[model samples]
Target: MKSYSAVVALAGLVSSVAAHGFISSPTPRQPGQGLKAACGDQVYNQQSSDHFGNVQGALQNLQGSQPDCRMWHCKGVPFSDAGEVFDYTPGQVIPMKVEIRAPHDGVANVSIVKVSSDTVIGQPLISWDQYALTSSPLSQHPDWTSFDIKMPDVSSECAKAGDCVIQWYWDAPKISQTYESCIDFKMGGGSGGSAPSPSASAAPASSAAPKPSSAAPATSATPTATVPAATPTPSKVEEVATPTASSGAGEGSTLPKSFTIDSFITWLRANAGSDTATKVSRAVAERAHPRAFRV
Candidate 1:
């Protein structure tokens, strides 16, 4: 009965916010059972019929909206008081879909944050951009469009730890505005799975900040390097839009069946010789962050 009400409630808000979009998959919300659980029962009451469309700020419509020191914005007070959680599996390519009401041909970005408790929002665990909606203004009105988002897999470590939030932000086409939404989920995978750099927490094949340049670490005093050393080699493999042709890797292969540039680099690290590997390794680190790489 209550579950039905939650669905109906969200549905009611779905009508007027036809200009932007909302998460339609993996169930988004505050904590308890569903959206109502995480966001609070009263959240539905505050909608102004046109709550989502044309809002200047992401959480501008929510009551008590305030600056979240750690995040782009917050509802000042917990809409649903935080702690309720959701569970997801690590290494699973979860499906995240969105319903874009008004097409602006914008772009979509997804990020994840690991929280220690339900009440606190943690620092960034994964920040990915353009994981979905390569371009925005999806279709046009009357022809509302659907964006199928490829959610990157979670690290086994974070999942077992419990409590996390997956945030989706869509850039308003031609405008400097963004629409934000989120869903809380816990990773339900085993602990032995591979993990990567916190920065590498996002999908490299389809998402993440713009590629970085190698200017941060190129020192004239130490021009060359070897062995392709990584301050830390993030083990989480990113799934690409196109799967890579499976290499004849043996049982211990640490790669996915995606022919990504990173995967090739991994192969190069092993077989491409030390000098080449060092050059590429530093370049890779520089790309992620100029200061992100080290010997």
Candidate 2:
């Protein structure tokens, strides 16, 4: 009887880990041949592995162990150079999947960054709130949901740079937690046929980082080789309540990364030039997330 009870307990534990929320579409966490695999470097899914971290806070990123959106450090997964690289076109429409094995209230953001070095992280090329602007993955999708994402164009230089990161951040506002993932890849295909949508583009590929100011131009010019100015701060959106995010947010964390329905709508409208952001104005943000409002 004792042996049977122990076996049953262990089985239950394994089931819970496998049943946690995970990104199933791109398969970055479990990428096979040809695509770089970095998920195994840290606590791929912490709350489960031995069930060590906070379970209810399965999405948390700023606390013990999983600091800065991830535990892999700023230079990215160590020895990543030995890993594989996924090949993609400059402007391809990519799809994403987030299996909410454990559904919770949150928002998702995806962005592109040029990995200038293994030691230094790069800036954003595109940033937007996937959940708030188009549809609420929280309320819209079933347990395991899949959605199509429009890819953005890269500068000829950026496309040829050979390495970049497609970063994803998930914020659980109701729970004050966040989850993160990245797909490393090499760009393929020709350039310049279609520019990135205004709603999708964020930081300039080659320019210095945008200064964190209330008055930065909505449409800034392309930059040269000089180091960028100060990091751009959250626009007026910082006034809203927000949870502390992973230090890993860097320059690519979008305005909706820290949302309170209001900030989300403001960001969505500015970039998308539509009323889509406002559509989800009732969104409740953190004490529950890997959250932010660019603040």
Candidate 3:
């Protein structure tokens, strides 16, 4: 009975094989030859594999034990080991997924800076506030983190047709180690047409008023009196009063010519409306410039 069952199973396998024609000599197909058969011929929907065959090469290097690969189960996996697949279009939201492993105790701060020509000196063409990843902690094992980054508008001058670099930096303060991974994405679409020229609207013409030719004279009998200009007088220069000489010699006489003790004292009195300045000036003057009595 066991022999009969095995023979029946063999017959069923042979029938399945006979259904599809078999090739005696296998002929390897060229790259992209059967792509249309697998997916539609539409440019946007067309699926392609890695040209250089290096999807795994772009992944972050892992050491020791790592997290199990969950990318295949995820909705949006940024890149496949076979190759990166994306629709080249402007004004579309592109989803990005990256696997990050902390392996040690620390915090990870990820910042994305988009470079384009329209990016001004102070302002960025694609600001970080526009797109960002939610704050989440990474465990020691490998973890898949997913985020979406929108492509900048094509109308912006900064937009260019090329690969856009998405840099991921993992910082571990406790371990003092950092890991960075850069993924290059190709951008498509030609520049949009030039902006429209502004038309100059003509302004309305203003009307001018005519001036009066003749003027009426005053009817008053008494004419207004005109005052004669006074002769200009020259200002007299007043001479400053000189200090009277006293037949006395004192410490003030020994003061340098550049500085006058009496004048300094007078200035201090005028400036020192406060009692503190008056007392300070009086004490300094009495000690430094005592008056001498004449014999």
Candidate 4:
């Protein structure tokens, strides 16, 4: 009787952990051979088995583990494993979809993230302050499950295929679980192509367009490469400052002027009080020391 009860409880726990979310359309990055090499077989297998698992879970598995995994960035999936790179233009509107097997009320956003620095380029393309709320059924809130994000003009930095990614970030802060999905893309000349409409169950994709918000442009005459300017907490749909020398890091403590992953990690460590920064910093510091980084 005791053994049977234990087995049932374990099954329930596994089922609960497995019920999560991930990007379904625009085909987010997947765990593959490169991931197995960089992250090691264990971490890669975990994600390969369950792509919807949160960052914290993956980090937990990374105790004194692979430094090259970069688990906090796109769940550490490498671009070499990325099968297709979508060609996009500045104004292109791309259809997107997310599959939430279980809802956990929190916030979500989509942004252009520079792979090199793990920094968001400009503001988020779309955001939801109240996302994946369990009070309402997924059927009633189609916007949370399906939407569209406009590609902002990132031609200067994202002209190359591997330089940037369209990243979908969802953080259920209450649960301390962060989920990310990245789409590999680059800017291409010519008119941006039209996207197919989302499924009938989806809310009108037009409704997902975020309100305009202020953010600093990447400056040319690179000032002291500090952290970045302030960005809103993950709970709100707000602007994300560009990570550049002119943008400044966080408050207090100055490292070298050149902005790199090390600098960003330094910033993350410095800004450890912040909700987003702190969580990510802890995972990064614990799992691996700074290694050659890519998104």
Candidate 5:
């Protein structure tokens, strides 16, 4: 009877160890090592649910729905398993890795797209090709699979200095097989991502200056001098001419021609103070009396 009891106790211990397969613990809130779920059996049905429930109960000490299963559509949510959020700058290339546990055979499709207001507030930041899992059939068993994704450059038109959402979809094909998860990350700051160029900052500076008025007068007034008119006179030889010739001459012949010439010389001397102007006047006067001023 003692031998049989020992055998039974050993068998129970073995079974208990076999029930938990690979497990990851929960992270700590204070930034140290987090709690991880112990490795357990890879069964997706009721057994997997019980295993996950044990993990959640151990951490939170609660009897509510399983931690992993509550938020996710899977049969068992890994205890203390949570996603993380990160920020990226525009035009930055980011390498990312994700591990997802599916309960059955299905495909996981990841993708990023411009987020329209109608569909969502922020834009899509990353996506991946559909990853199909068929090794473990629909046994409701929790099997973990990992994937590496490279994010493309974010365009300024699609994303701005705001928050963006990254979505992860597991078992997306069938109606009842869909599971959705998301992480909210911001894009901006002097991180690895590119920022909007400095040229954009200079645009407002140009518009701050005031414009000149068009109604002001263009020119100011200043005084100007008017030139005197020249007076006409009869020839000097008219006075010395015969009486007959004088009588036939016009009425202007009675005026003294010498007096008019003298008045012109006096005005020229008064205006031509500089020697250069006097020389120019003399040269002009000589032209009228070429033969007399030859010497």
Candidate 6:
């Protein structure tokens, strides 16, 4: 009876030591063939028996074996066994649920991490400076087990599956124990992704439109470029009814098509014998200088 009692106590102690916490919703990475290959048979089997095992415990079993284990990152789990990827978009509110088999007061945070480099992509989606505390009643802090994480505009970085994960990290500094749970996800892709940057969206429009030449204004010395000569509107110039070669007495007359005050004076000097021209020239001069041509 004493031996049986000792065995029961030992089993309870081992269970309490191995089991801790893990992400329950969104189905996090679990032990698989890939984990066995990367973390080796001993460490892998240990974790396989108890999915909630801490990282420090896994690291201790990984001492001799150089198996592709990165115990500190995602509990040495690889993407090969990451299962289904959850699809998300920017500003999306994702509901998360965690299972805490044992409580060890610590700090916890959820962040988007790049799988390959194990680098956090941005600030944590959610965090608790003091989480899973034994001093506080579990009923007091309900957010410790269930909460929501809003997705960020990661753009193209997390567009593909297996590239990123929503990792939950919990560290108990006092006990030197760390636990991780990774939920594989893919965000920012297709038409539902974050809008393209302003510069990128305007690229095609800029390429299609004609760009102004820097030297065209200063270098082009064409007479047609002066005043209304370059203006395509000829009807405005023709609207002014004037005595010129087009409407004058002679049909084949060789004179300027449109004449200014100075040009009229020149024409009058050359045609001094024409009484009609002289009369029109005096009328124009009177209108231009009323005080000078008062008499």
Model 5 lDDT, residue 35, Cα: 22
Candidate 4: 10-residue stretch with minimal lDDT: 286-295
- How well does each candidate superpose onto the true structure, as a TM-score? 0.38, 0.41, 0.24, 0.65, 0.29, 0.59
Residue pairs with backbone atoms closer than 3 Å in model 3 (clashes): 67-142, 117-158, 118-158
Instruction: Tell me how candidate 3 scores on lDDT.
Output: 0.25
lDDT (0-100) at residue 174 of candidate 6? 52
Model 4 ranges with Cα > 4 A deviation: 1-19, 192-201, 204-295
Query: Can you tell me which runs of candidate 1 are displaced by over 4 Å?
Result: 1-18, 30-85, 115-162, 189-295
> On residues 1-295, what C-alpha lDDT tens digit does candidate 5 reach at each position?
4222343344233222311221221110111111222222232233333432222112222122334232221112322333343455555443333334334333333334223321222222322222233453322222222222334444453344223334444432221233343333455445743222222222212222111111221222110111112222222322343334333322242332333333423333444333422332232221111001011
Model 5 bad stretches (over 4 Å): 1-85, 90-93, 113-132, 136-144, 155-162, 172-175, 193-295
Give model 3's clash tally.
3
In the range 1-295, model 2's lDDT, one tens digit per residue, is 4222343344334323322344444634332221113333233344324222222233221223333232322112322432334556644656555555454444444555444532212233223232321234334332124444445555443454335566555444333334555555556564322212332222222322222212222332211122233342323333445635541122232443444545444554555444333222212222211123222
Write down the RMSD of candidate 3 (Cα, Å). Answer: 41.0
Find the candidate with the highest lDDT and give its number.
4
* Tens digit per residue, CA lDDT, model 6, 47-111: 88998987656654553446487665688888887976777888876677788887887767677
Instruction: Please give the TM-score that candidate 2 achieves against the real structure.
Output: 0.41
**Candidate 4, residue 4: CA error in Å?**
23
Query: Using TM-score as the measure, what is the rank order of every candidate, best first?
Result: 4, 6, 2, 1, 5, 3
Better of 3 and 6 by lDDT: 6
TM-score top scorer: 4
Name the lDDT value of residue 151 in candidate 3: 48
Q: Which lDDT tens digits does candidate 1 get at residues 151-221? A: 34554434543345665555533332345556655565443312111222223333223212122222321
